[model samples]
Every structure is written in C-alpha cells, then in structure tokens.
Target chain A: MENVLNWITANQQIIYIVVLMIFVGIEVIGRVPSVLHTPLMSGANAIHGVVIIGAIIVMGKAETDNYLALVLGFLAVILGTLNVVGGFVVTDRMLEMFKKKK
Target chain B: MELNLLTLCYLIASITFILGLKMLSNPATARKGNLVAAAGMTIAIAGTIFLYEQDGEKLHNYAWIFGGLAIGGIIGTLAARKVKMTAMPEMVSLFNGMGGACAALISLVEFNHLSKQLAANEVEISAVQPTVLIIVLGLLIGSVSFAGSMVAWGKLNGRVKDFSFTGQNILNLLILLVAIVAGVILVLNPGQPLLLYAILGLALIYGVMFVMPIGGADMPVVISLLNSFTGVAAACGGFLYDNKVMLTGGILVGAAGTLLTILMCKAMNRSLQNVLIGSFGGHKTAAVAGGKQQGAYKEISLSDAAMVMSYANKVMVVPGYGLAVAQAQHVCHELEKILEEKGVEVKYAIHPVAGRMPGHMNVLLAEADVSYDKLMEMEHANDEFKTCDVVLILGANDVVNPAAKNDPASPIYGMPILEVELAKTVIVNKRSMKPGYAGIENDLFFQPKTSMLFGDAKKVLQDLCAEVKTV
Candidate 1:
C-alpha cells in the first residue's frame, strides 16, 4: 500500500493528465454524428499509431545481443507503422467519398 | 534543450489530435481535420527519431527502424488504396488488429527487458510492481483485441462462420477469469515468464470465443467494442513509456469507440450485455422456432414497380448490405435520377445500422455521387415516410420490418424501423425470401401494401432504371 501511494505521489502529474484527457475525450467525441462514425473511428485508429514512438524507443535502447527484445521491438514498429499509415489513408479515402456535391 | 524540443513536438501532436477530432464532428471540416492530425503525427514521429535520448545516449538501430517503417508504410498505403468500399469494415478490423498486435508486442518486449534487469539485480521486483501490472494488462487487452478483431475480419469477409455450443458463454467467462487470474499472478511474481505466455494464450482463446457466437447483424457494436479495447491497450503502452501523445490519442479513441458502441446498441435497442452474450442472429432456431407463420407475399413486375415509382409524387429509397454486395449503388443512383427527372421527389432513408457498419449506407451513397442533401437519417425519413407515395427498399430487410415494432417475442422487437408501411405503396428488392443478415423473418414482407420484387440488387436497379426511363 505504501509502495502504491509512493508511486501515485511520484506520478501525480501523469494521473492528472490521464483523468483530464479522459473527460476531454468524452466531451469532444460525444458530439460526432453517426454519419462520421466509421471515418472518425479510422482517424482515432491512426492516432493510436503513436505507439510507434514507444516501439522506436525500445528498439533503439535494446542491447545488440538481446535478440528477443530486438525482434519484438521490430515487429512492434512494423505493426504500429501499419496502424498509423493505413488508418490515415483509409480514413482519407472514406472522407473523400463524402465530397460535397457540386 | 533536446528534451524541451521533443516536448514541444508532443504538445503540437496532442493539440492537433484534439482539433482533428473536434472538426470531425462536422462534414465541412472533416477532411481537413484528418489532414491536420496527420501533419501533427508526422511532426511527433520526426521529433522522436531525431531528438529522443535515453540516459544521455542517443538512439541507434536506424537501419531496423527505417526499414520496418518503410515496409509497413508501403503495405498499408497500397492495401488502403486497393480495398473495395464494401470490404471497408473488414479492412478496418484488420488494421485495428495490427495496432493491437503492436501493443501486445510492446508489452512482451518490455517484459523481457524487465526480466533481464532482474537477472542483473538492478531493479527490485517490489519497485517494479506497477510496471508489471501495466505490462500484464497491456498483454491481456491487446491479445484479446487482436484475436477478436481477426475473427471479426474473417466474419465480415465471409471467411469464418458463427460457431457456438451450449454453455459457450459460460466457458468464455471461465476462460476470461483464468486469464485475469494468471495476469494477477504474473504481476505478483515477475519471474515466471511462462505465466505471461499462458495469459497471452488464454486471452487469445477468450477473444475468439467472445466473438464467435455474435450474429453478423451485431458486428458494428462488436467492432466498436474491440476498437475501444485496442485503444485502452495502447493507452497502457503510453502509461508504461510516459508518452503523453500516445496517452491522449489512445484515450480519445477509447472514449470515441465506447460512445459509438453505446450508440449502436441504442440504435438497435439492445443492451451491450445482450449483444455480447445473446446470439440473436447466429442461429435460425430463435427466429424460426418461435416466429409466427408469414402469409404469402405478392411479387411485383419490374415495369409495374417502375411505373409506381416514376408516377409517385415522392419516392423514398432504403438501401442495405445486399446493395453493396451487388455493387449497385451507382445504378441505384441512376434510378433515383430517373425518378427525379419525371418530376418526382427522390430521397434516401438511411437507418443508423442499415449496413455492415454504422453510417455504412451513407458511405455507399456518397461513393455513388449521390447528393448529401438527399439522404435522410432515420427520424427525418420516418417523418417523411408518412407523406411518401412509394418506399422502394433495395437489398434491405430488417430495418423496415414491422415485427421490430409490433412483435414483442421477436429478438429485434424494440428496434426502431423505418415505418415504410406508412407509404402508399412499398416495393422490396431482394434475391429471395431468405432472412436478412439477422436470420429473422420480416413480417413486413407479407403486408398487403408491400410487394416483393425479387432479383439481384444491381440487376433490379438497372432494370428499374430502364423501365423508369420509358415511363
């Protein structure tokens, strides 16, 4: 219990950010109409591609001899990139179809 | 100095994500919103690649990093460019699964690093309890999301069939319990690498079982739920690495997905629990065993259907998944144009869950170059149906079924339908009387005012267009 409290105290800033962001997320996302659900989903999917940063950090820091970490990190980078690039491109395609009628 | 620059970049990325999501609420700014977010993502990635430092040392392994990025980027771009509009739901599932896989791999890699640190006696297990918990959670959630999404992708593409045995839901629950217990044990005892893999295995199994029995009609809700799972899993990664941008993005997606899931459930008038456990459309037993006998339905000729639509003062069209299957949106658009040319008002009625995904019908119609103003959502279209002279249902069944409103015993009883029976005449186009994606018989078919015009959606729309032109 003391450990947990210490951790919480040390990471108070992170906890605040997380809580505030959750509310912001709910408030902002609540207004999206059903028409844009799929595109918005795809867009958010792209956003989580920011996990690529984590993958990059891990891969860069792993020792050359740590094959397991290197391999797993490489795959993470690949999948994260796929999520980011594919998500944005697919969302763009879907949105393009919604082009205003001339 | 470098750390400050990196923080600035992350701040920019976070702001753009918020602005992008905010703008996505309206159609006018939606495309630009997506572009703005993408630009922010680029800035963040570049900053991380150039400025990120660990323990006073810069990152290496550029060859591996850039190579993986190149391969993934090329494959993602090509796949996204080539996918058919009708196959979009599965494509989304596939890509979301990839994200889940990445999060899981991140957990695995981090766990391996932690074990190595323990071997070197550098960090105490007591000090790393929180990190271990996050790693376990990321693994559990990410694995489930990945496996469940793969199954969803298969189901959407018709590569997998719904399979369930009696007590399967209980079995799923048991499996989930075990996985959670394993995760807890692994967190408490960080030395057991095998337990971690066991949790991963159990999570994957639970994910498959979780989605295996869900009826196809409920896919939108399931996809939304799983999307949120992936988001939460990604957020765990953010928590592990203290990446603010990742945390914000993941939270946003998690919230968006949860809200969308709730909206889909409400649209269908089903509770989330009911959607998860009850197999509404997976089997024919519930619909067939309890369903009241349907009377004979009358068929309408192409010419007569065309005449009714062309001469009607107002015609309202309802489209469904079968239309996309037949690749007939363009032809349907042509029929609408023809009807309008005859001085008839033509509009489309889009049920919220009309197609495979939410707003799927709108995407289809938009792709066909149908004017946005002419497509009416359910409430507006329901109001207009009363004044409509003809309601032409193309490749659609469940949304217009009166049983949803009238029959309490029906699985989809409380779902709000289009009230197409209110129109003067109703023409339904379908391949046959085979039940809709939900496997439930629509009572609206046997109504006196309703006429079935059986054919492929594309062929029927093409013939209807030709006939309407003559009329």
Candidate 2:
C-alpha cells in the first residue's frame, strides 16, 4: 500500500491528464439530445460497474484465511456484475428502438 | 510481466469504452455502441480474473469469481429482459444501486484489512493517507448512493411514498455533518474500526433522508444525481487501486452522469440546490387561489374525437406519464398510423420534463416503433403547435397546463411545457378530471377549444381508431 501510494503520487500528473482527458472527451462527444438521455444515463450507469475490478484487486491481496474479505469481495463481484450486465442490456433494449430500420 | 499485460488489456478496454460512449451520442448507432461497451467490459473482467498478478503471484479463487459472475449475469439478464418499458427508470436505479453497493463493500473490506494490518505492527497506517481518503470517500459516497437509490426505486415503482416532517431538512443536514466528522476521525486514526462503521451507518441514513422528501416531479433529477454519486464513488475505488482502466471508466461515467444531472435540472428550470433541499413537488392539495370558479370542462365522445382528427390537416399527440401507466404507446402509435393514412399529418409533442425522466416519452414512443422524425422535442414541438390543427393530448396533464406559462403561483411555473393551447382545437384523453402527478388542475382542460375524451388511453385510442375508420 505504501509503495503504491508513492508511485501514484509520483505519477499524479498522468492521473490528472487522464481524468481531464475523460471529462473533456465526454464534453467533446457533443450534445446527446433529450431523446437519448435515458439510455445515456443507463449506459453510463453500466460503465461504473468496472468497480468489480477494484474488488478483485483488493481481495486478491488478502490472506487466504480471511473469510470476511472473501464474503464482501464475492458479493461485490456479484453486485458489480449485475450492474454491468443489466445496465448494458436494458440500455441496448432502449437504444434498439431508435435504430433505423434497414 | 503479468501486471504489465493486465495494464495493457485494461488500456485497450478503456479505449473501447470511449468509442462506445461516442457512438451513443447518435441515435443511428446507439445499440451497436452499447454492444461495443459491453464487449469492453467483458474483456476487462476476463483479464482481471485470468491475468492479473500482484507480488509475483497470480489470482486464485476462480470458483468464487466465476460462480458470482454466472449468478449475477443470469439475474441481471432476466431482470433486464422482463422489466416493462414503463419501469425502466426504476430498473436502472436498481442496477445502479448494486454498483454503488459493490464500491461500498470494497471500501469496507479493504478498511477492515488495513486496520488489521495496523494492529499487527506491520505497515504504518499514517503512511497510507491517500488510501485512507479513498476508502473514506468510497465508503461514504457508495453507501449513500446505494441506500438513496433504493429509496428512489421504491418511490418510482409506487412502493414508497415521500415522507417528511417538520425539521426533516435540519435532521438531514445534521446527519451529513456527523458523517463528515466520523470520516475525518477515521482518516486521522485509520485503526479505529468503530469510526469506519459509524461513518457508514450515518451515510446510509443520510441517503434515505436525503431522498425522502423529493416528490415524483423531481425524481428525474434525483435519479441523475444519485447516478453521479455512484460514479464518483466508483472512481474512489479506482483511486484506491491505481488501476488506469477502472479510473478511466469511473471518470467517464462520473462525467456523463454529472452532465445528465445538469441537463435535467436545466430542463426543469430548477437549480441543483433546490433539488438537493428536496422541498419541491410534495404539495398536492394547494387550492386554486384566484377565488373564481374556472369554466366547466367539456367532454368529447370517441366518435367526435375521431371525426375531429380525421378532418384535421395536422395533429400533434402529447403523451405523459399517464400514457405510460396505461401502456398506451403502442395504441397511440397505431392511432398515428391510421390518422396518417387518412392524409392527416401526425407529429408528437414531447416536453423536456415529460413522463418520469428526460427522454422518457421518446423511449416509450420508440418502443412502439414510432419513427424518430415524428417525435419532436419541447422547443420544436412548441413552435409547431400554433400551426397544428388539433392537439391530441393522451394521458398528459401538467405538461400542457397553461399554468406553467401564465400562472406564476403554480408549482411548475417557469418550467417549459408544450403550448397545446396554441392549436386551433385540442382533444385530451384521460380517465377522469383528476389532477396529474403535480396535483394541479390543468387550465387547458377547461379552455373553450379543449375537449376531453374520458377513458383509458389505450381503450380510448382503440375506439377512436375504429370511429376514425367509419368517418
């Protein structure tokens, strides 16, 4: 944990650029008209489901005998997975309705 | 070597996500965009499970990981497939809540482990200040988003009613203060397990209180705000681990949610502070204060409505949450088609704050396979109303209420609405004379040019369609 802190602090500039890049990237993607707001909200909701990776990384470093960590990590994985799957599926369902019929 | 590979995989996945989000901005490619993002998520998940390594050791517990993934996948797929279009908002809230719970649980487990390490005389707890800040922020924001989303879900699906008492706002503020104090103490002394629990408990309660007083009218903004909270909390998880993919994904969602929230507020003409205070939209019984009885409303039979529409040169259909409740979008679309066949030009009038959320009406109408060009936004729709021959409002109320434009005392005043009264003639389909979710009587209902067709929207639309064939 200490070593990673030192590394992140050292690379703080990179983190700043990445975060700024994303914020600007979203702004540049242009205006999502009001018609697509719901799907956009749902799709963005799915993107945060990436938190599952954080759960795995945390649990991977824990001791094998740590039952508490295992249970919490497992549930986190399940919940995060649900968010990713359901969020994307529902968003696709909504977006499909807007697709131009070929 | 394994860590470097994992980083590369995450990088590629993040790029795909960016592309997916970009694609989502346009209607033509939105579905394909969702698929692209889903593929990226799949790669990120698989890489983390199979390739991630730390301290020169690969991850174990494949059984637990895969088992959880399979179960969650099935549940999510079924829920998404089975949810009716009308309930999409609540479904989104539920799924988003789960993400928040995951972020909160991650912080909880990590904090527990860190405290244990401190007690074992291992690493200095003070040395991990950034980690502590991330854990505290994640714990607080994640739990708030989770609990608050549950309350929002309940409110949206009609299982929960807004609850408020005198001094509730003060109580909410106090809870926030206590939670912040607890977070500070926990950050200063990371070994105190009790302080962490206190922060979590306070935040959970605050989430509920924060959303308890907001009424249905403001739910779109509330939902958007909570979605942003989940995003920021997820980013905290990313910061804790220094994972670039996680950070990028979190930032993307966080930024998108924030933008959505701002847009929602703008659509409603309400400030963010007014929304967070949770004071608007709860008054349902305020009397019409002008002390004069409004004109009696007139009712039009289904046949008359059909005749009027058949003879009109142009018809604009205005839909609201009532249309959604009756599941009438399909029938409404059928009516549109039938009217179009009669040489009556048909268009839809959509309010920015129509239905339950922004773009909610578009989703409903699109599900009924209504063409994208026919669905007009509030600004565009308002402009066309003066030229429209007949404005047919189906199961909508406040969005057409002239009160929003003329009556400053009305709760929804200053909000943009469809100028339905501008049309030459107006026909509204509703079950009764009851007020809408805002509980304000619509002045448009009593206008000389406006006549109501009383019944369920679907049934009324069906009867009107049959009568139109006769006409």
DockQ of each: 0.76, 0.61
Residue pairs whose backbone atoms clash in candidate 1: none
lDDT of 2 by residue, B313-418 (tens): 9999999887898899998999899999999999998887788988888888888989988988888988999999999988888888888888888877988888
DockQ of candidate 1 compared with the true complex: 0.76
Candidate 1 local lDDT, B344-455, one digit each (tens): 9999999988888777998899989999999999999999998999999988888888878887867777888899999999999999989886668887888999999999
Candidate 2 interface CA RMSD, Å: 1.7
Fill in the DockQ of model 2.
0.61
How much of the real interface does each model capture, measured as fnat?
0.73, 0.67
Q: Which residue runs of candidate 2 sit more than 4 Å off their true CA positions?
A: A1-11, A14-22, B282-292
Candidate 1 contains a number of clashing pairs equal to 0
Evaluated at residue A34, the lDDT of candidate 1 is: 77
| Reference-based lDDT, each prediction | 0.87, 0.84
Candidate 1 Cα errors over 4 Å, as ranges: B282-291
RMSD of each: 1.8, 2.8
